[model samples]
Target: MQNISNSFFELLNKIQEKKKGDDIQQYFAEVADYLFKHVAIQAGETRFTFAEIEFYYYKEGEFEGPLYNCTYPRTRNVGKFFWHYSGMDICFESSEEKKYFGGILIRSIKRGSEIIAGPMRCSDEIMNSCDGELPYLVYCETACETPVSTIRYGIEADKNQNMKFCFYIEPETWNRKREGVLVADKATGRYKNVSKTDYYIAEPKKR
Candidate 1:
């Protein structure tokens, strides 16, 4: 059986290999447009209520799934709050294995038929068991339920508006923690763990 790190690496490789230029951007744009037209306009509000859009992809093609609303009993309260106040969550799954890859949380709007959104990393339940190296079990005696650490990936724009695929490690903690991004090794062409400062320094600033 493949470990979580290896599985995640393979997923990233698949995305890097299969994705054409602007494909991801175009996907997000379409999602944003759909939300703006269907949800925001119907609600008569600039901010959207809690909602989710899931997509599935195989080696051949991509398919968009159904949209979810906060009325569902299982919808997370945090997700509802974020969608109402911030953005909506978009999840990705593999059609071949029916496995979840991850998701991006984006705040979007329509400006004269043009959709604009900023992608941010969002946490997701990738697997059933927490036996992987990526996420660790967090034991808490006083808490009602223990939470696990998770890793999230998304596209983020830097100070110069240069966008890059980034990963964030969210440890189980009450306080805020520093986030890190993945760096690609020139030799292997695979991503390796790097400090946030190193990532910022290594990436060239765009004009």
Candidate 2:
């Protein structure tokens, strides 16, 4: 396991390290084309396409439960999936245009008027005592397929029984590299953590 000793927020905001002549762009372009065509073809049209594709999920009534970021730490690194703390933002080249597809499962967690983060619901008493920041796990899930691997869709209730998240990573080549680590800030000489801080995830978690 990799141990990061920096402020996680700073690390996540740092510009991603890019190598010369990386083919990842080409791959995303192909994926975008495939997804766009897949949608249009289903409608029996070859020349039609959407300017954007949006998806949203909501739970009715009071949602009082833990939100975890879906991950398979043993199988894939969790750092690459988070874009900003809100959701996973992926950019793909679609035909003649560049498009972004973002997904976020949990918007906010609340107990009464106060918002909560992490496994424990935040209360007024807890907020007054905390200092600095604590880390919290959030749930994330996705269905992905490529020409080389298994293709599947939809979230299964039984597989998520444990409350731990399941992550779908593409290409074994991209999973092993530790590129997201923000080791040092040139101006402050401090490192940042790539993981989400409790306060950053919810207002109630803040001190």
- Which predicted model would earn the best lDDT? 1
What tens digits encode model 2's per-residue C-alpha lDDT throughout 88-125? Answer: 22221111121112221222222222333322222222
lDDT of 1 by residue, 1-207 (tens): 111233332333344344433365344444333332333221211222212222222333332222211111222211122232223333343222443233434322222222222222212221121233332211111211121111112212222333322222112221222356677899999998865421221111111
- TM-score on alpha carbons, each prediction: 0.24, 0.19
TM-score of 1: 0.24
Candidate 2 matches the true fold with a TM-score of 0.19
The list of candidate 1 runs beyond 4 A from truth reads 1-22, 40-88, 94-100, 106-161, 164-207
User: What lDDT would each prediction earn against the true structure?
Assistant: 0.28, 0.26
**174 Cα displacement, candidate 2 (Å):** 3.3
Off by over 4 Å in 2: 1-63, 68-161, 175-207
